[model samples]
Target: MSATELAGTAPAEANRIGAIETRGIEPVPADERTGGPRQLFWVWFAANISILGLPLGATLVALRGMNIWQALLVAALGSFGSFALVGLISVAGKWGGAPSMTLSRAVFGPRGNHGPTVVSWLSRVGWETVNTTTAAYALLALISIIFGVGANSVLTVISLLVFVALTLVVSGLGHATLVWIQQWATYLFGALNILVGAFLITKVNWDAVAHAPAAPVSVVVAGIGVIAAGTGIGWANAGADMARYQHRHVPGRRIVAAASVGAGVPLFLLIGLGGLLSAGDGSLASASDPVSAIQVMLPSWMAVPYLLAAFGGLLLSNNLSVYSAGLTMITLGVRARRVVAVGLDIVLTLAGGIYFMLIAGDFYGPFITFISLLAVPITAWVAVFLADMLFRRHYDPRGLMDTGATSVYWYRGGFRWSAVLPWVAGIVVGLLFTTASTSATDVWFSGPLADSWMGSNGLGWVVAFVVAGGLYLLFGATTARRLGGTSSPDPTTRPGARTDGEPAAVRP
Candidate 1:
């Protein structure tokens, strides 16, 4: 087939459908892959980081205090490129039959995979915490607006618990459940935001929006990095994992692109606008509380609809939070049925969710910090995985399966010590930078390097990528020459090979 023909027709989407038509084993069923580009778009749309705005916006507001335009610019910069990274990751699902976590085996090694997977698990758990906390806050705000009780009242606790329980119940169903929830939530929230935002625009002063202060470059850069990291990490790790199931009739790359934009951009705008609106007025304190902001934005007549819509969005957020948690658990080699794995995820997620809801005071800082910290290793793994595929031709041609678990990755118990050193160095540098920026005057370095490491994790990601790649090449070269001498075959140019079902082990 011509490359374009090969790229377009019988593309990644077709490979997935063929597997399903032939009754192949996969985590999510083929019927679940039924969405067209539009559906994929909405899925992406709903996936955009919604509550993230409250925390992220709050940080900027506290630091440099950006106004609406400035906030939007930061969001745009951070949010746009994220989807592309995710789209690249989604290629694995389409080409290889693995889920996001499963794909880690290639770069992380079978035994080494546990590090990335654990990092992924923690990241998802942190997300669950943020969702639960946001839901709790939103519910309390709504209850006060509707019935006049205080936000921290006993009644609010009961309401939050009930919602958490419900989230847990629904989260147990896996992909089928997630897709359905994604559709309904996106429609409900999208409509509500439009309706309320329109009313608010008419009622409120547009001058205030224009008068808002511009965000500082440093703050804007940090904000963008935070948003980009939040939006892209999982998607980058698993976009293909979800996209792989697209029906043969669906266009592959288009679905990926649509899904990315749908999920990342809308959420960015939604949260960014919320911050803008809240900041202009004294409601800045409740910037994270979408329902309250919604009610304030609209007239009494529109309150019910806005609340209903916001509630749906909240549910949708929890659904994804819990669903992705299920994905991480399933990546474990324990081999439970898909349904069972999801059930486990729901239970575990609920416990963690509730704990965070009750205890986490400043949910935003920890939410961003935990995920950003965990992302370091996963990003390293991804950088290495892509490099291996591009230059080393690691996969067997006939099956397209990455059978390098033994020859390529099996070095040092499948954990490259070389890669480990770089990872440690990156973390240490990133952490030191973070500490120096936050406490340089007290802890010494307060000048150039402090700013250099001001938003240390952001720089850490790039450092980790370069360091890991360099270490992999250095080690891979020596190992390659010693094991087989001369040269190693390229993966992309060769015919595919079948798998022996020996997925890279993820020993933690």
Candidate 2:
């Protein structure tokens, strides 16, 4: 369908203002926004209710030796904590009415902001690539089950292309269409998950649940860290992308709840299910590759529909990732339409996913690498980011939108050392405690915390937040952030920006 047709089909209430979502990086004008916090809940809730979450939880069960309850507890703790950050950053959505990365320009400065933007872009693409790959894996497995043609190298390639095609079409249609699609997709996912969850419940072995491997205290702590990093810190960079188009008067608390509960519930549930399935004596329990075990669960009749929903659901998941990726690209001074930028993401996804699928073995290593590597730096960045919001109590959305001489963010050739220096420090500190392995391990700088108290793999979240936030306070992120530009009142606190504005990406 044409983009016009897609937009036309959306509910009138959603598009009543007739805001053309063409301006990718600009602050949204007040008149253009048209939603309350309720929309945010559905957007994130639907996105999280996918098969993508299973591997994270399943790994915790089989690899970390966590019992079902322990895995669920860790998963819930992480889900609650990380998603809170997602909610905190989501406040920028209503404040700036622009992409979250663009709003970040205020903190990082224009040129310096590009660093995080690129990092955000790469990280989203990495996760999206993994999402697509998992969908491809499941879809191919279904094809194998039905046709009796084994899922092979050729089918894997085919499934990926099919997945990529779906994401491009949905995201290419842009925001309003994407939102509309997610609402219905979420309903479908919820229905399907209920069926799957019930099926899994009947198959659980309570004996194994009782006798599952006992985890060390360090392992339990690390597991909580891993789950927290994966679920909580996971949403840090993308919060504003989801909520930016919310009506300005929507209470901050509501937006926070919308983003937090939206993603957190599904993550905790799905991961818990994976852990439960792994711990049981069901068909999945003895499977050599637990991540691939979801394939065998469906009855013959439900098989195709489940696969269809799973693949369709992947597009729902990838849409926002690609959408934010495009916005991040635009924020980094890439000049392109959001649709075109998403097209670029498709190209990269194609290359990256294919390359990884070919040479990758034991997804255990890659998944940990992907999540842990990105988790810490982002935690540090968000730490400083949240602290900036708290201390400054204001951000001029104009500075993010303007990107010109008078803008307060235009400092030191568009680089703010206050933010970036501390962020870099946080990254190094995070990595100091980070260990490189297929599974979570400790490295040189694992610190006395790990030496005496717990294992080091998941400690970056706390360390980064504290170090980066403290450094920013010392660097005067609040009092004096720029050398070349004079400070002003928070742009968002003021009723308006000096210039007429246009709509930008909403947080999801």
Candidate 3:
């Protein structure tokens, strides 16, 4: 089928303006895959150009004790390097034309994929909730600056509702709409951010930034780990979700470049600026309300635009997350339309936002703890998924959608222990070196090796990735090749065969 025929065959509402996407967990037809790599650039760039990076940078200086120069280097390395992995994994989406978790059916069997899918869903929901809370704070700050009304429970609820509603509108519209919004929004909000950023630079105390002592190499390494976990590692699982729309012919290198450069450039600038701001005033790192904290540094005249840009940025990020979370929900066996899944995810986000905004005692404390704990499993999954990607280039689309016993991915009763064992072992090893805390004095979970160099340096996620990928390559490589090889039974005759007449791949 040609592009025109494929588009005509699709439901009119699919990817149409103001229409909820109807597709769920199935491979998008190759003829319908119209997007290219450049679109991915905007998608990732816009998703990441949020004000959240500022606080991440603040943490590096205020909590981790790094100077501006060291912070910049860490920001560059962590943001670019981790996202490069994200881009690499995205290539699987192009090959399979399915969401990330759906593609994983080939590596871990249908049932076995659940563990990583659940973790990915939780991570997306957590991040969306945090984005909602932060965006709400920005809206509240805007109201206070414009109308002189102080924040109260009523305003808090209203603000959260507004952000969540906006997220639903964009994310619920699904792929085409998100791709369009991310591109234009990146232009509009990206420019506004630069304007606000320039104004912010003038406020920096260069003397303080320049004179601050450089952090020791160990802390620098730790800062890199912190930045990587906070920025790219958190985004790794969702990488291929957006890439499912891209044409399979697009070079894998282009996909990787798009994600790395697009996200890396802005992150480095934003994080470095954050370090500069913190160098002058330590308040940003410890600020109870980050929106208000950053607002204090700007002149009253610049407050409105700054807050608007901040809100817009967070909305962009949240939309992508909510969209991915919805896909993840379907991958987790939620029987509903994609839009319906998005609505369910938003309900959880609203509840989490209310707790963090109105009931929680501290923000950064809990925020850091959330990142620390979730990063381990997410990284472990990424490692195993990327490892699987090495040997399995073409995904058997029918096998991916078919969860029954006849499915090629039904290795040993719906589970592939080769992948499952490495993933579980990775998480276990990671947690041993992991330490999570809600505050300096309020420790959440501290492993036996928490005080060791890897633990102390916040490299548990790194250790997890290495262990999982290495172990998979060592023990699971042959299994992966055998399972993904052309010897598998033909899927075209299967019950779940592609009705669209797309050719089947030999391996998944």
Q: What digit string (tens of lDDT, one per residue) describes model 3 on residues 1-508? A: 3212221234534766566677776888887787898999999999898998998898888778888989999999989998998899889889888888888877888899999999999999999988999999999998998889999999999999999999999998888889889999998999989999999999999999889898899999888889899998999888889898888789999999999998998899999989989986789988877888888888899998899999999999999999999989988887776888999999999999999999998877788889999999999999999887765667776677777676767767788777888899999999999999976689989989889999988888888999998988876546435655332222333335442334333223
Judging by lDDT against the true structure, name the best candidate. 3
All candidates: CA RMSD (Å): 7.5, 6.0, 4.4
Better of 2 and 3 by lDDT: 3
Query: TM-score, each model?
Result: 0.75, 0.85, 0.92
Worst 10 residues of 2 by lDDT: 499-508
Over 272-372, each residue of candidate 2 has an lDDT whose tens digit, in order, gives 88787777444342333433667566567766666666676677778888888888877776666667888998989987777767666644456666777
Give all candidates' CA lDDT scores: 0.55, 0.71, 0.85
Q: What lDDT does model 2 reach?
A: 0.71
Compute the lDDT of residue 454 as modeled in candidate 3.
97
Model 3 residue 54 distance off true place after TM-score fit, in angstroms: 0.6
**Candidate 1's C-alpha lDDT?**
0.55
Quick one: best TM-score, which candidate?
Answer: 3
lDDT of 1 by residue, 442-481 (tens): 3322222334645442555555666666666676577556
